[model samples]
Target: MSKGKEMEGEDEIEDLCRNDSKHGSKKRLVARVGGSSSGEPQDADYSVVASLSDELALILARVPRSEYWKFTFVNKRFFSLLKSGELYKIRKEIGVKECSVFMLASGETSWWAFDRQFRSCKKLPILPSDVCFQTGDKESVCAGTHLIVSGKEFEGVVIWRYEFAANKWFKGPNMINPRCLFASATCGTCAFVAGGIGMETNWKVLNSAEKYNPETKSWEPLPGMHRKRKLCSGFCMDNKFYVIGGTNEEGKGLTCAEVFDEKKNDWDLIPNMLKDSPVSTSQSPPLVAVVNNELYSLEASSNELKVYLKGSNSWKNLGPVPVKADVARGWGVAFKSLGDELLVIGASSNSYAGHGMTICTCFPKPQADELHWRSLDKGCTNQMSHFILNCSVMGA
Candidate 1:
């Protein structure tokens, strides 16, 4: 491209970016004072740096987020643009988004972020909650730019939020009623959590639910679920929050699932949602995800992937996942919706214990003759343990 086109692109980026920081002005003044007296070149010297051609711009605009790590190798301009998050801001301004994976593995101190293709990986800052919170079981969900993780702390149940834009972890804006083992889901900028074990005078399961807003940094109570439950999974489909397959207060596996209707401000319970799937005491919450408004689940006992027949409230098996889901009853696996694909990360059945985890994705077609799974070449995915403790996917 000619100088005119390059200048046009840079000008466009600056127009779209947030540049109101007073610190930026101070830094520019210092640079000008330290250099030429005329200072006419200050603007040129302080030009917002980024490098991409017309074709490359089209290619990188909305690809899998995992491919971002390669930008650091492209050139220093690209590296600076990414590290400063200006590119992400630019993409957001243009209304383009792709999903990125954030996961915590067994025996790891820090959570890691993987791009969609698993071609690049970056370690997030370590969560600073107390040891009790770190050691206990946790539930994670994403709303807007906040990644919220709830766990039991020494003080009691607490929340930790990871802010994507700042690249830092923040201690709540906690729940209105703090609890653990709850069902949670994200829709657009809001998150809904429901039905978990709460403690008072004794161990008791709860029917209460709450909605969290990242913008407000606070949780608001919602109408309770139909039945008190724990060890359930949650997801958003068709703009509704649904919780499924949990143990009731009497410690019995429940086939009923509940959907929260925001307009009605109430929950509609659906029975026999998981009647066909086995539910053992040792089994983990149903491994479920939603892609393009369709619900899918991983059957831990059979290592099978099943799609929910929403109209009939039944399930149809899509075939098996490439992991040992049955080994730990689906406890240590990461199952999440990655844009248009279903992503699973866990130890393969034949993989040696304590070895690397396998990452697989599939573009599921409901009732397709054969479900195809493709294993991508791993990047830094092998750096952590094979077991996944918590996982959340966020649009970036």
Candidate 2:
């Protein structure tokens, strides 16, 4: 095989060792803490390669933005190995090459990948500059192997699908009406989208929702919500889907929430949203998580985090999201628990004009009620900073 075009897919890389002498037949690459070795470093060569496969797997589990990119320049050998198609699976696992913030004429919208990670905001090959979206309000949901995006840039809403494995985009079944700022979720082989507002000058509220099945590749209408809502939030939990918190046509915030059971093919009202600072209408979906056996949510717009105990059926306001609402931009909060502590990722534009992005991590600072969501970096801001955004936990 030629060195330039040595192999076919990942097999080419595996075959590379057998066919080429340049990659080095006998010398193995090692992982170093500080930098690379002439080959692999000497101090930890054996241990590094001994666990190279597993270590690579762990590195792949890291989110793509800052941590994953750090590994690319670690060493020539590591970079070569990661360039293989096998690493595409890792990139896919890490949600690399997914949606990034793309600024549009209408207020900014986020375009996500099948997995909602690694986004390219500046140049979208197929997505026109006008198209943008935000996933399930509470937490961005993964677009399935077949995924769809809705909402609009200036005039109206249109839904589109992304084929990840094929690296192509296709139009999908449309919604009953054009809307933006609604909740969209995917489970198994189907996708459920509902409740947003119209884009036309009228700015009418939407109560309609729909489901798309991969098997049929067709959409079937679901009963519209009891309330016509705009700016609502929805997510799937315990195999049950929930929609919560959005104002109706009257422009009053809603405490009423609802859930859908797949087996029954029906929707039912759940508990009212926990009483808090008057429900924030400007807020995106309140960030949600399940930590320490309780369901916790963070309202960056309201600067509040609340925990709900299923066992006791009660709510407790935990700690205010360590950053001010003005400081927290869309996609600001990325939540993941490291052992016993819940980590909250917060980022906001340094200015309303959206010149840059600021990222901060909120974890208990060795004490209670003293949360420190420290800024990690500021230079990586993308077009998505102007609107809603999300950070998903990556698993190897």
Candidate 3:
């Protein structure tokens, strides 16, 4: 091509690039490609540089779990992506599954959350006035992102649900019967409450069971267990619900365990846990939790942590509860599974008012013989007045 024609073509391209800015084009050519009249390259559209989904996933994965609730307010797309399963998948792939520990104070109707990343505790919003009266020995369970609390009010059985997304508490459907000290566990999408003492007639022990469907905001009765149970412990594993160690109708400690198969709509009595472990049936039902799909129980009598092995149908002692000598007694202690660690929180059993509160974390490894428990919070202030009633771990 002739030199003049080549120069003319370059000038024309530069003119188009310069006009793009004045015309408010979403994209523009780089200065290196065609000199801009402004002497600076136009900003490239970030969406064109990378897909929106990929960019959003990257950003959301790095966001701290505690700050996640605020990010949802960015916009509708941000809110949807933050709550979607796709973002969770990205978090899993990036190893960013952050678990926060939620605890309810003993006498007060207040809730407290400890953020593992920040190593700090923050008071959560107070429960609604209707449900604020619920304190002491209430049955609470976490279903998906909602915290469901079931307790007895003056009128009858009251159910309250708190959603992290909304940071608000709302009333849920009332139970079929008013009861307390019930066995509660969440499986899949529903929360199941099994045997507990009824509010009517001398607080009669109940064998009745019911499942709460959050989507429908209703409760449906399930097949009652073979025997009435009170102070029973419930856990969901293998897509089934298991109720462990509780007192019978006659106020006798129960040794037999029962498993509810949802598909079969039947409860099968499993081997007795008392026979394998030193879990005392005299006390309230032992603390049971599922971590990494493995069942663990904290036997208050022995103050030892045991893991359930399905093949042997028994619990093997993982180790003793990791805490100071005084707190190791396991009195009023609560255990929660946070990611790969077990969080233990309670006051020292030896002290009536001086011990404050003890918080410990233990990481279990199959091959490691020494499962060291790290004390995250040694009570500096006396927490004897407040009880760490229940705890739950939520991943954001």
Candidate 4:
């Protein structure tokens, strides 16, 4: 390609961010983090380039995505690279991926993405999804670089995807089945969703499953599950997809879990796997995550952390987690895998007074009795400090 911009401006952008000036506008303060006016120290200067050669794209991809807004504000050429998703594509080709947390707080109009350390955050553009979709429950999963969120609208279920490359949300590419309260998990470049309630007027429970391919921007039907389940949870372990702990069509909770075998292209039922734990309507889907191929669960009824024993198809308690998952019944909490650590964000069991939240992580092991949980940073201001309605981790 031909060189497009002059690539000569010396004007540098502000350093990453500043806490929302307690009194000023949160949006303006956040915007200044990228503009040239902030008094913060100079960010590592990246000169604007005309054509994004693979070498330059590699360098840009290496930069944390939290800093990308600065480039877009200063150079149109750089903006096109981001808007066209070329830079994101280059990042994937070189095996460059960063894990960040995306959360939507209760009463918040838009979603906010925070860097892994919670050092900075950026507000996303308002999703144009209908008002009904906004008020209803939604399921979110990250496939490749896209954050796909599905929920109910006025007439039916709708899917909206936030493309990291383009930095925008687009509607459609809906599931071939289009359902809600499904079990979803991210595996490599694709996302697998299964066992949800259908959109029919009678609201039938479903056992069907499908895979979303971000590269093709379409959903491909997968073989159906053995049981019709809704409000379930899904995870990936040992290169296989597992669905666990959801109510069946009878409106009774299920203890049996199922694993999808890629080699066999079918699901194998693991009976009475969750028989040890109690299930009720008050509880959310199993608060579970896999770190280093080992499964962990934060029992929502109690504040305890437990490890799954794959050999026995059982769970072993790892002692109490720092956060209070019981108060919300596992709802409004974030339980996800952050690289090799298990990340849990919620009200503190110590003394949770308001909508504010606290974060903690642990490198879990099977037999570790007293697993040390280290508190991580919480976001600034009440805007982010509110109850978390939805949270998902994206590795892009």
Top candidate on lDDT is 4
lDDT of 2 by residue, 170-264 (tens): 66556555567776655434667678776653778887777777546677788777777777766655666667777888988887777777788
lDDT of 1 by residue, 1-396 (tens): 899998886675444332412223323322322343332322222223233433233335455556666665645544544555555554554467877788998888889887778787788998988889888888899987779998888887778999875689989887877777788988877889988888542568988999998767888999988899988889999889999988998899999999998989999989899899888768999999998899999998888999989888788988888888877888899888998999998987657562568889999988775588999888787667879999998886
Candidate 3: minimum summed lDDT over ten consecutive residues — where?
26-35
Give the CA lDDT, 0 to 100, for residue 381 in model 3.
Answer: 20
Q: Give candidate 1's TM-score.
A: 0.81
State which candidate, 1 or 3, has the greater lDDT.
1
Candidate 3 lDDT, 179-228, residue by residue in tens:
88888887765788889888864788998898887656678999999889
Once model 4 is optimally superposed onto the true structure by TM-score, how far is the C-alpha of residue 49 displaced, in angstroms? 4.8
Which segments of model 4 are wrong by more than 4 Å?
1-52, 73-77, 352-355
Write down the lDDT of every candidate, Cα atoms only. Answer: 0.78, 0.50, 0.66, 0.80
Error of 1 at 137 (Å): 1.7
Off by over 4 Å in 3: 1-62, 69-98, 107-109, 116-120, 130-136, 200-202, 277-282, 323-331, 348-354, 365-370, 377-386
How well does candidate 4 score on lDDT at residue 61? 58
Candidate 3 local distance difference test against the native = 0.66
The Cα error of candidate 4 at residue 150, in Å, is 0.9
lDDT of 2: 0.50
